[model samples]
Target: LAKTTQPISMDSYEGQEVNITCSHNNIATNDYITWYQQFPSQGPRFIIQGYKTKVTNEVASLFIPADRKSSTLSLPRVSLSDTAVYYCLVGEVGDMRFGAGTRLTVKP
Candidate 1:
């Protein structure tokens, strides 16, 4: 499993763009970067994923550089309801480990 490093907390205003970056210095070539968003009392949901370069979905975007040592999760036009924890994971299927996540607070 690849260890991930991310901020403990972040803040953003309504309608603002929020970017949370995760570092995985020891990622393997077969690993993929996956991001998940979790609201209070709810399970974490998948946001975006990429092996290299960028992948965008209706909810968020994931950016991975050529080296794939790090990734960024970009959330556009966030609202108060978007306040939650964000997790960055690097692994192949069935080899992921969930650790502490980045807490995002979206204010009005």
Candidate 2:
């Protein structure tokens, strides 16, 4: 199993873009990769997910390098409402492991 590493926290202002990155070493070839966003006292919500190249949605974009050892979650034009803890997950369906997560504080 791979272990992931991420920053403890990050700060950004409203209307700014934020990028949170996670690094997973010794990742398996079949491991599923994804990102989640969690607000205080709330369960994590799916944000963006992918295992190769890049995947984009209305809310955010997920970028993975060719080696698949790391990924970055990019949030465009974030607002105060986007303040939350973002986690990077890797593994099989029922065995996914989440990183410590990056706490994003979107200030006004």
Candidate 3:
């Protein structure tokens, strides 16, 4: 499994776009980049996943460079309700693990 690095906390105002980057220096070819978002007292929910290039959905977009050493999660026009902890994970099926996530605070 590849270790992940992300900010301990981040602050944003309502209606602002936010981008969180995670680094995985030892990422392997079989490893995929996955992100999850968790609200207070709730389980984390999958946000996005990617092997390389970009992947997008209704909630967010994931960007992975060719080297696959790092990735970014992009949220558009976040609201106060969007405040949550974001986790970045890198691994293959049986080796997946979650790291200390980035806390995002969205203010009104």
**Against the hidden reference, what TM-scores do the models get?**
0.95, 0.94, 0.95
Cα-based lDDT at residue 39, candidate 2? 98
Candidate 2 per-residue lDDT over residues 31-54, each given as its tens digit: 867889999999999987797999
Tens-place lDDT per residue, model 3, 2-108, is: 78999999999999999999999999878888899999999999999999999999999998988888899999999999999999998875776777799999999
Sort the predicted structures by TM-score, highest score first.
Answer: 1, 3, 2
Off by over 4 Å in 2: none
lDDT of candidates 1 onward, in order: 0.90, 0.89, 0.91
Winner by lDDT between candidate 2 and candidate 1? 1
Q: Model 1 over residues 8-78: C-alpha lDDT tens digits?
A: 99999999999999999999988889898888899989888899999998999888989888999999999
Q: Runs in model 3 with CA error above 4 Å?
A: none
